[model samples]
Structures are given as C-alpha cells and as structure tokens.
Target: MRIVDVCAFYTPHGGGVRTYVEQKLRIGPQLGHEIVILAPGDEDGVVERGPNARIVTLKSPRFPLDRKYGYFASAEQLHGALDALAPDFVEATSPWRSAGLVADWAGAAPRSLVMHADPLSAFAYRWFGQVFSRRTIDWQFSVYWEHLRRHSRRFDHVVCANSDLSRRLAEGGVPRTVTLPMGVEPGRFSPLNRDPALRARLLAACDLPESASLLLGCGRLSPEKRWPMVIDAVNAAGQQSPIGLVMFGEGRERRTILKHIAGNPHVRLFEPERDRETFARILASPDGLIHGCEAETYCMAAAEARASGTPVIVPDGGGAADHAGDGAGMTYAACDPAAAARAIATVLRSPRRQPQEARTITQHFAELFALYEDTRARVRMAA
Candidate 1:
C-alpha cells in the first residue's frame, strides 16, 4: 500500500501533525506500506528524501497579512504532483486550501481528513483575541465552518483525534467520523534512559536548587494552553510547598507568560532542548507534568511524560483523561488553579514510587496503527 500525506508543514519545520506523520512513515513500512509527504517549501523549493518516504516541496510565498496563508498552493500545482505520484490513499492533516485540492484530485481514491485540533478553538486564536474583535472572530468561524461543511463532504472518511472533536464534527453534521488517538514513541521517551548528570546540569542552569520539587509543563505557550492558570497555580502552591515550576516550549504568549511569572523565584520558563533525549530526561526527572489546557485532542507531551514514569495532572474534561488511564495520573477541573495545585501536591506527597504501567499506553498506539492499516486495506479493496 502506498499513502500520500498532505500536511501544512513537514518535520524539522512542523509540530505535532508532522511528528505523527513521521511516526507512521517509520512504522508503517514494517506493516507493508510506502509513504510519501507533500509540504510547503522553506527558503527554496526542493525535494528532500527520507529513509522511508520522499518529500515534495512547493514554493509558498509568505503573505504579509498572514504567514500561514502561504499553505494555499495552486490547485494545478497540487493536482500535477498527485498525478505524478498517484498514491493509493491520500491523507490530509489539515482542512487548508491544499487539502481541498487533494480531495478533488483523489477522485474515487480513499481520502481521509485527520482533525488534530478543534477548529472552533483555533478560530478563537485566529480572530477573537485582542488583536481582533469578537465580531471578526464570529465571522471568521462562520466562514471556516461553511468551508469545512463543503469540503468535508468530499472525503471518504473523517478521522478525529478525540471524542470532543468528533462530537463537534457530528454536531456540524459531518459523516463517517472516526476517533483515533495520537501515539507516543515509548522507546524515545522512556524513563529508563534518564541521565542524572544532565538533570543536575539543567537544574543548575535554571538556577533551581537540586532538592527543590520540580513540576514541568511542556507545550506551546499560548492562550489555548491556559499557561497563565499554570503559573497562578504554581504561585498559589508555592505558598505551601517548596515547589518550582519549569515550562518548555516557545510561542506568541511568551511575554505575557513571563510577565505573569515575573518576580516569582519558584517559576522558570525556557525554550525546550533541541534533543529529544534531553527533553525525555527532563520529563522523567520532574515530580509531575502539569497540563492546563482544556481543549487538547490528545496531548503528546502528557502521553510521553506518563510513558516516562512521571505522573500527569490534567483537566478532567478533555482527551488527556484517555491518556491518564487507570490511575497512571490524576485529573483536575479546567482553569481551577487550586484544584490543579492540590492534585500536583497529592502526587508529590504520595510515598509510592511504583513504576507506571506505561506499556499499556504503548499498546494503545499499536492498536491504533493496526486499525489504520485495516482501514487502509479496506479502502484499497473498495478502490
């Protein structure tokens, strides 16, 4: 089986979607599938080849108004590429302009749209912020919804990352929806590979004491992430326990988040380490992972942390619960700093240091991959 993946960006220049695609490309070959990637160009348009896949890049001019709008490559260009590759299945990771083109070009071929995030949640960022008025946000969301309504009917299947997203799509009258949770690479993010020396070095670099309790939050620093609530919780918690919060990842909310944490000696926010090994070590070394976001479809960071034997504390309402599974972690109410702090405190105070049953979570990924393969095979037979 040959699959063509259409995404806004590819690895080295992308985020969660790219990581998920790369994981599939790496593991899918073992299950008898060849994968190819189509992504927007950076610097100069050029083809870059990977071990199990080949990437085709198209030059996307960065518009002054919206940098992301460049993902809208010409339909002819996209169709030309699809004509050349003629993949057995085409998977679009976003509902962008390029994705619509792919669906049109795919014809009767199996085409799937994977919803990684809630479109409404994204709409809040794109238009409802201080930069744009509430009216603008409403208009943009309406336009987005209409666009999705039209193009959604074109795909053979719609894959949602969580039940929340699936519910939202169902409410919007989308057909053939399936919930598929994201996966984590246990080998790359295991606790067994933690380096004590690296931990000490990292703590020292952050001006944190070696004995201080460390709580970690890893994700984009944005409004949707609700990082301010995390900071507030840490501040409130510091009044009781000797806890220090360390956050990884950079985003648009950096200045606001830093200002909120300013003058608080117990909080430190920095960009993530370039190496995955170092990042995994940090997660393993932390006392617990703090997740403040309520809109997560499936948080890869939380999954990785749990797989690293570190307990996670997330809100009760989102897809994070699906990853928490069987007391491997705890869940708190969304936006409740006190509840979050209490959960983290409980995990820290507990004497039990039993290893988490992360193998079960890894098995979930294997099952998802099996399902994907099965679906792909059925699609091929029908085609």
Candidate 2:
C-alpha cells in the first residue's frame, strides 16, 4: 500500500519525528510498500529518498516561535498534493491544524492519527506543572481535549507511539487509541559505538579526569525540555563528586541554557550531531544521560541510550521513565532538581547494566505497517 504522512511537526533539525520519518522511508520500501512525506518547507519541491519513498514539500512561511520550522498556511496546495499523490493510507503526526486538514480531506483513503505529540504536557502542564496539579491542568485545557476527541472520532485509528500517551488519550475521550511504542536503530546505535577519545575530550572540557562520571542531555533546547532544571540537578550532584554534563541540542532557548550554566565548569552545551555515526558515538561515550523532560511522547534519546548500553535518568513519569526500566536506567520525580540530584548520585554510585532487550526501528515499523494494512481492511469491510 502507498502511505502518505502529512507532518506539520517535521523540521530539518528536528529531534525525534524527523528521525522517525527518515527511518520509516527506508523501512516502508523494505516491507514492499511506498511511503511519502508531505511537509512544509521554504520552497515547493519533491525530493526522492528511494524508488518507493520521497518528500513532497509545500512552500510555507517560517513558524513564528522557531525559524527552523515552517507552517503550512495554504490548504489548497496541501489538498492539491494529496489529490495528486492519492495515497492508499493517510497518516497525520500533528494534532493541530494539519490533523484537522487531514480529517476534513475528501479522500477515500483510510486515515490514521499517529499521535506523536502531546500538547497538554508539552505546553499547558509544562508551563503550570510546578504550580497546578495535573488534574487541574487537564481541566484547564478541556478545549484541546475536546479538539482531539472531535478529530479522533473521524479517524480510522489513533496510534500513539507510547503507552502513556495512548492511555492518556483514551482517558481523555479519544477513541481507538493504540499503544504502539516507537524504537531506535539498533544497528546504528550500540555500546560498540562508544569512543574513548571523544569521552575524554568532553570530560577535559569540564576540567575533569577520565574517572569522573560524564552524563549527557539531548533534545531540542526548548521551554518544555526544562533544561534549566537538569543543569541545576547536575550542578547539585557535582557538589559531592566530579561529574560533567555534555548536552547536545539547539533552539530558541540557547541563551537561557547558557545563562543557567554560567560560572559552572561541569556543564557544557553543544550543537546537535547531525551525522548518525557521530551522534551514536557521542551518545554511547557518555556514562549516562539525564533528561528533565517528563512530557516526552517517546523519549528517543533514552531508547537510543538503552540501545547503546548506556544508562539514562529520566523524569518519574511518561514515556522516558517507561523506557528507562530497572535494567535500562533510573528515574527521578518530575521537576524536582533535588530528587534529580539524588538520582544522579545514585546512578553514579551504582553499576552500569545493559538493557535486557534493545528495541529496533525496523521491528517497530513492521508492526505499525501491518496495523495499517489491517485498519484499511477493516475500513473497507465496514464500508
């Protein structure tokens, strides 16, 4: 079947969604299917990934919040692309206007809302989480919940990349929520990718020796990431022992991160690694990763670390915590830097253990595509 993904969340320097779509492009053809991406870009064009996969870009203006991303303003162009492509299955990753567009599209193809983002956690809860309870936050964002419910009722299925997100959606009145957790590329990321020289260099920047514990933090440098909290936790943990944190990410909050890490020698922020090999090497070289974002739908960084035989410390809830199982890693209370510091110290004191099982992107997409086929079959039968 030919599948077209209408993605408004995709960006050139995106963290997880970009990685996922790229992986899907290769995996789809391997499964004897065609995959196409329709996204907003600075210009309109088509870029072929392979014989069965390609990206169709629609000319759009830069998104106001971040210049790295673009927003689709013209529905005519989007619908025109969908009409020309004529996909057998349509999937939308964004829960905003893009999902609404897909829902209202006059197409025969069975549509799926592959819920990749959690706006409630990413925005509302992140903003007021420290002040208001989650229950209160949810009540305040009733409009978004209703919006999701309306769009969900029109879709064949609502696929969530994490069980936590699926459960949340199901409870929030979105029907047909399926828990299909995403995965990493095991072949590309592994303990074998660890580079001793790289590790030493990063530690040296912190003015620390090889014996010091080197932690990593990654993702888009954004408000939702709560990077300032992570830096505080790392700083607190550093009080007792020599520890260094090397963060990889870039975004509008770069200056905030810089200010937070000012006068601190143990924490350093670096640009995200675009090269897969170099990224894997940098990821595996660290003793562990400390992620402050509790709102991740699927913490790809944690999963990649797990696949790399590196431990991870994540917030006590959400997908990141789920991925950081006992053998995989550990967790601390969300938004609690003191607790995070303790968790960091505890991880440093404990032994490192490789994850019992490493999940692969290939395995994940195989199941996802099979589900797509089944959903299409069911839709046809119902018709």
Candidate 3:
C-alpha cells in the first residue's frame, strides 16, 4: 500500500509531529508499504528516506508567530501533489487551512483527518481562559468545533490521538472519531537505561543532594504548558521533602518560567535533549515525570517517560492522563498547584512502578496501515 500524509505544521525543527512522521517513513518498509509526506518547506524538493519512502516539500510562506514552521496558503499545489502521488490512502495532519485543501481534492484514495492536537483545548481555552469563564469558553469553542465538523465530514474517517479529543468530538456530534493511541520508540528507553550517576548529576544540577527526588519535566516552555504552575508545585513540594525538578525544553515563555523558578533552588531549567540515546538514559534515571499541561493531545514525552519505567504525574484531564496509563503514574486535578505538589510528593516517596506495555513504532505503523487498508476497501465498495 502507498500512503501520503499532507502536514502543514511539520517543520525542519518541529517536535512530536515531526518525530511521528519520521518514524512512519522509517518503519513503513518493514510492513511492505510505501509512504510519502507532502509538507511545506523553504524550497520545493524531495527528501528520500529509502526506495519506497520520501518527503515531498513544497515552497510555502513562513508561519509568522514561529518562523520555524510554515503554513499552506492554497490547495493548488497540494491538490496537484496528491494527484501525482496517487496513493491508496491519504492523511491530512493539519487542521488549519490545509484541511479544507485536502477536503477539496478530487482524489481516488480514501482520506483521514489525523487529529494530532485539540484546537479548542490547546489554543482557544488556553488563550482565552483568563478572559472567559470555563462555561463561556466551552460555549465559544462550539463555534470552532462546528467549523471542524464541516471539514471533518469530508474525509472517510476522523482519528484522534487520545480519548480527550475523541470524547470532545463525540459530544459535538462527531461520533465517528476513532482514538488511535501513538507509540513510543522501542529499545530507546527502558528500565535498564537508568543510571545512578546520571540521577545524582541531575539532582546536583538542581542544587539537590543524593537523597533528593529528581523529577523530569520535558516539553516546550510555553504558557499553555503551565510551567509556572509546575515550578510552584515543585517549590511547594520542596518545602516538605527533598524533591527537585529539572525541566528540559525551550520556548517563548522561558523568561516567565525562569522567573517563577528563580527563588526555588530545587528547580532548574535546561534546553531540550538533542541526543535521543542520552535523553532516554536521563529519562530512565529520573525518580518521576511531572507534567502541568492539561491540554496535551498525545503527550509523547510522558509516554517516553513511562516507557523508561519512570512514574508520571499528570493532570486528571487531557491526553497526558491517558499516556500515564494504569500503573506507571497518577493524576491530580487540573491546574491545582497544591494538588499537583501533593501528588508529586506521594509518587516520589512510593516505590517506582514497573513499566507498562507500550505500543511500539512498528506496531503503530501496522495498525495504522490496517486501518488505511480497511478504509480503502470501504471506499472502493461504496464507489
């Protein structure tokens, strides 16, 4: 089978989306499938992965807010590209204007809208939360949800990354939404990777001693992530126990998050881990993973942490909660620093939970391709 993914948010230096797509391209051949990506780039070119997988880059304008990414202006190029690829299955990972472009394409392939992020929860609520009440924000979100429903109906299927999005879509009368949980890389992170020396080093970086609990926070430092709340929770926990937090990632909210952690000697900020192996080892060494974001779509970092046999403390809501699974973690009420602090202390004091079973990248590809094959057969029968 041949599959083509049209993604507008995928940049040269993107985070989870990029990682997911690259893994698919790299692993598709093992399942006897061909995959290609149609994405916005600085210049039009083809980046070859192997004989059957590659990325087709189309020149497009830069995303103003973050120049690292680009946005699709029109469907003309994408429409032409889809016609050329003539894939058996097509996927639009972007929910922006590109969604409409994919919807308008007159292609024979069965298409799906791979909902990677929740606009209402991740953007609308976070951006307007201060100005509007929860009820008001949800009511206003109905407008955006309605807009999505229109375009989503154009595709054969709508797949969500987590249960939070699936429930939201179901509540909005889009019951066909399927929840396809993403997988973490196998072998890259494991219980065996835990290093005592590395754990001590991380604790020392936070000005903590050997007895301190080293908690890991990995994600973009942004307002939506609520890093300030995380720092406050860690500080509050530090008052009662030997706990420290070492955050890994950089973003626009760096200054704000840094200021929030300035008075707390137990919290330290670090840049994102560039090397996957080293990152995985460090992840395994942490006593636990503490997350503050309540609007995550898939929470890949938390999944990686769990795969590393590190317990995770996430909000009771959102995709992160789902990633925490049944055994490797616990959840606190959303946006409550005291609750989060208490949860953190509890997790740090308890014995580490064994790593739960996680879907591997190969397994994700196999399941996704089977879905595509089924969707394609249905489309053919309908036609």
TM per model? 0.84, 0.95, 0.96
- Lowest lDDT 10-residue stretch of candidate 1: 356-365
lDDT tens readout by residue for model 3, 92-191:
9977788889889998788888887777777777788778996788787776767688988888878887888888788777646888888889778898
Worst 10 residues of 2 by lDDT: 352-361
Candidates' lDDT values, in order?
0.71, 0.88, 0.85
> Across residues 215-261, which tens digit of lDDT does each residue of candidate 2 receive?
99999898989999999999899899989999999988999999999
TM-score of 2: 0.95
In model 2, state the lDDT of residue 80. 88
Arrange candidates by TM-score, highest first: which order?
Answer: 3, 2, 1
TM-score attained by model 3: 0.96
On the 0 to 100 scale, the lDDT of residue 210 in model 1 is 72
Better of 1 and 2 by lDDT: 2
Q: What CA RMSD would candidate 1 show?
A: 4.0
> Can you tell me which runs of candidate 1 are displaced by over 4 Å?
42-52, 63-69, 123-143, 194-211, 351-383
